[model samples]
Target: MNKSIVFLMVILWLAQGLYAQTYRKDLPDIAISKDVSLHFISPEPIQYVDISTHAIAGDLPLKNVLRLKIVPDSVTHFALTGSVAGIVTVVGESFIAQYNLRYTEGQAFTVPSQVNILPEHTRPLDVPGIALTSKEMQDFAMRILQQPAESTLRKAKAFGIQAKLNHVYTAGDHIFLDITYYNKSNLSYQIDEQRFKIEDKKITKATNVQSVEITPVWQLYPNTAFKKQYRNIYVLKKATFPGNKVLNIELTEKQISGRVLTLKLKYDDLLKADAF
Candidate 1:
């Protein structure tokens, strides 16, 4: 056999092998109207999920009536509810699946069906979904700032980030971290980005930290302070805080240049969860 022909055959074989190893698949479609619920199982831990909707048979716009209630039963399984009367496409880190929501006139919809997706050779990608809007963040901050300071769990000042952990509570499987940020600096400072991470000293290796949903005020005037909150949910794997683990929250300033404020959280700090 010719050398070029042999090389060409080897390349073709590799291409076929690569194509055979797939990760994403489509979920079975269903007809739905009013309120409905569905369950889907993922072969691997879903790190990220993207939800989009479309109407197939109904005259009503799905976006106007659509609301999602996604509850994770486990790392790979979840239940969805709400105004799901149309098609929903769920693209996660390791799988791409679709659910068809058919409008069945005025019939009350319940649990439709369960979908199970098998993982393939495709690798998961790092993608972030939408965060809270500016107005929403500002309003939430205002509400927190209005509360009296004496209600806070722990108040401390450090590294230009004078703040207090107002409240910490767990709703269902999600954890909420409510905090207030005070500007102790002489000049005005604006928040560039907020970083939340779980720092584990036990393991020297890097941890697969989960994403945080936060609401922060963009700017803080001199001597003025704002409050922000974060929700840590939908984490595929959660870290245990018993082994000297601490939650680090960093607020960076773009106006004041490289200045940053760090707030370190211990396990004890999260223990005091009370109404404020």
Candidate 2:
């Protein structure tokens, strides 16, 4: 099947929260400089945006494919890389468009007041943080769903942790808990600085659980549907579930006052690994 056809099917699945996007096929093709510094400006606020060029045929250099960065300098103007180039398409929750451009060694280019965030019935929500948008989120969510469901250790939703748990395992005396934190409400939390803690609900200053460590499995930003759910793996030390089958976990936002999430985990809901 044609790549465009395949992408269209995926696009349809995402049309619900996305705007109809198209490229300015008629726009004059731009030639990029050797340094690959391309720039453009958007008139309206881009709630989320991503830009990429499709390979026409054979393999392209890894740098060309990976160096493409859409860095928003401010609310409207942003920078693009010209070092590697091809036909670039820009898409967002409320906007969709493309720019036909070529990256030629030693040639630099700047967009001349081009590109528009085509009007849409549903306006994009101006959420704080990265402008990666929802397209990337949907792409990631699909990837997560493609994983084997049996690999999921425990799935639960509460305290800003959305939908499902990613994975869980135990090695020696430590317990590893894979979790994804998401923001579905108008309220937003700084994911990068988020923290976690595990304690016994029944006992005050209990000595049962030793230590808990958190490792970010993925970097999270705002606006993208799946991106909102930042993935993390908690390395718990000497953690043991009591006979009563209850676990208490807390999520905290240092910047916000009274912004803490308490998760009540039941033993029966937890899928134990073979080691346990």
Q: Give the clash count for model 2.
A: 6
lDDT of 2 by residue, 1-276 (tens): 999999987866564223222335564465544344354343333333344432222221221121233222211111233223445544333454455555443423453223333343123444444333334434444444455544544455554545345655444444445566666656655433444434444654545754343443222233122336556444444344554545555556545443555555555534454332
Clashes of 1: 2
lDDT of 1 by residue, 1-276 (tens): 999999988976664443231222354445443344434455433433434422222221221122333322211111122223334544443345555443343444354534454344233344443233223334544554566545556566655557676656433233445566666556555567666666663554466644343332232222222433222111111233664676677767676465677667776765554322
lDDT of 2 at 260: 54
**What's the distance in Å from true for residue 91, model 1?**
15
CA deviation > 4 Å runs, candidate 2: 1-163, 191-227, 267-271, 274-276
lDDT of each: 0.45, 0.43
